[model samples]
Target: MIPALRQDRGQAFPIYVVMVAGLLFLAFAFFAVGQASATRNGAQGAADSAALAAAQRAREELGLRFPGVLTAPGGLDDIFKDEGFVAAARDEAVSFGAKNHADLLPGGWQPHPGRTGQFEFTVTVQTQYTVGRSVIPGTEQDHAKASATAVIELRCGLPPGSGGDNAPAPPPVTITCDGQDVPVDPLPKLEKIFTVKLVD
Candidate 1:
């Protein structure tokens, strides 16, 4: 009887060891998954912020370049065609992506082509982060990518012949800067003529 019990004890010990090993493996897997998720979220956030920064800078540029037009009684059809305006916006997007520890993909900063009235910019960014310190073989480092779009809309309400000195006083013009609708009071001083936002 004693001999039989010793053999059973040896078998049970191996089973216990196997169970502990399996549990440890599962724990490591869960940890890796959680870490990857966090990294992805971070990458997404960076993309959003970068896109927004780019759009905001572009909005500012528009305000500065078309200060008189924005406040005057006119439409924004011609201003969108300015090449310098688009270039400035793209440069800002790249700079913002770099600041967020992400790199903008080549030709990733794209302005919507068909849509002329509203300004829309899209940016794609990539970021790499470590999921584990060489513990998960090929998963030691992972790459995360995200894309975001921002829009700038102009809103103005001017009375007919409002530009003339004899014309009645013009109502305050409002520009949709992202989500905020800011009023542009007085002339030659455009305020919030454009807005920035993340579309995706």
Candidate 2:
């Protein structure tokens, strides 16, 4: 009877080992699922933040000069280049776990001038995901995209229609160093002229 009992115990050891292995597998699967969920949440937060930053930058650029302010005399392209809007958007998106390629993020914009006393700035950022192992070997990794639009207040030292009411205005002040009316240029350090404000 003692020898038979020992044989039974030895056979049961294999079954116990298999059961433990199965339990370990299940725990690992649960951990993976939790990790994937956390990753997605974090990635989504990053996307929203990046989009907002880009849009804000675009809005600031649009409002600068803007035909009313004499601080910076130029067009929208100057502000776009000076503010580095695209680069900022790409940097923000890349900072949030987008590391598939060095140039992983691509950003673009479309200007929609507001007709109702506001300015619109639309920014779009696209990047490839970098979550580990979630993208299976045979399938392509997920793509992340974010977009945002910002409204800017166009105000200067004067209010709207300050020059006149439904009438043509006179010529603006022009600086002259020699014979001709030399255009006044803003300082190079003057990059962003729009101030950020929070309204209730």
Candidate 3:
């Protein structure tokens, strides 16, 4: 009886070792998956932030070019046509991406095409980063990237024109944003019309 018990114990030890090894492998796999997901989310956040920064900078540039109250006659051609506009946007995007621990890919900064005179300036940014160390075999280094877009609009309305002597003076056109009424002739405040959102 004693000899038989010893043999059974030896068999049980090998089975237990195999089970523990399998569980360890599964745990490592789950850890790798979680790390990859975290890296991807970080990359996406960096892209979104970078895109917003680019769009905000562009909006400020437009505001500077069109300071004060803007009438209907003026066009955005000059602002868009400036050679430095695109460069400035790209620089801002890269700067923001670096701040978020990501690097902007080559030619990752692009202005939306076929959008002219709409005051809808859109900028897309792609960013990539490496995960913390290499846990998974052949996956020690992974590239995670994402893109985002932002838009800026001009909000205004034409006041009714006075008719004749009997007609009362037209009320001043007002611009309100985020619940605050903007001054009728204040300096260009794109914050009132600018909106940043993640599109991808």
Candidate 4:
């Protein structure tokens, strides 16, 4: 009876060892998954930064040009439908992406408008770093990629007689932005009138 009991105990010891080894591997795999998730979140953050930065730069440019557009015939239409700045703003996006440790992909502009003077920029990026070695296959060489769209919307209400599209906005017009009046004379307060942000 003593010999039989000892033999049973020896068999159970190997079973316990196997169970512990499997649990350790599973824990390691979970850790690897956590690492990959963190990397993906970082990539998304970079994409958002790149796209928002580009939109803000374009807003600044628009601010500098707004009052002048009020005088030029068809300028408001051009301003509202402008796709020129998106291409010009690519350098800005690239700089921003680099700051966030990512690189911008080509063809960042989405030309369709939400309304007059609304533009969307679609930015795609790839992380500069890999997910690192993990139990997951190919993650050691994998780079997480993400895309974000930033929208540029005109916040101030266009004054009456602006004729919607293709008509020049007259000078001495006061536009309402966030319930405050901004005069077009002596430079329009465009920062309040133009808002740039990231869309989901």
Most accurate candidate by TM-score: 4
The lDDT, on a scale of 0 to 1, for candidate 1 is: 0.67
Please report, as a residue range, the 10-residue window in candidate 4 with the lowest summed lDDT. Answer: 163-172
Predicted candidate 4 versus true structure: per-residue lDDT over 53-172, tens digit per residue: 888887877776777666566645567555666666677888988898988766544435666668777788989998999888889998888899888888765555663555554564
Candidate 3's TM-score reads 0.73
Better candidate by lDDT, 1 or 4: 4
Q: Tell me how candidate 4 scores on lDDT.
A: 0.76
lDDT of each residue in 42-84, candidate 3, tens digit only: 8778877887787777776766655322332322233345545
Candidate 1 on 1-200: residue-level lDDT in tens? 99999999998999999999999998987887887787777778777887787677777777775645443434344556665677787878778877777888877778774354567888888874555543376766667788888877654433334353433234446544445555555433433454456774
Q: In candidate 4, how many clashes are counted?
A: 0
TM-score of each: 0.76, 0.46, 0.73, 0.86
Instruction: Choose the strongest candidate by lDDT.
Output: 4
Candidate that beats the other on TM-score, 2 or 4, i.e. the better one: 4
The residue-by-residue lDDT of candidate 2 on 127-190, one tens digit each, is 4443455323422354344454544433223223334333434434443222344333441222
- The TM-score measured for candidate 1 stands at 0.76
TM-score ranking of the models: 4, 1, 3, 2
lDDT of 3 at 43: 79
TM-score, model 4 to reference: 0.86
Judged by whole-model lDDT over C-alpha atoms, candidate 2 comes out at 0.44
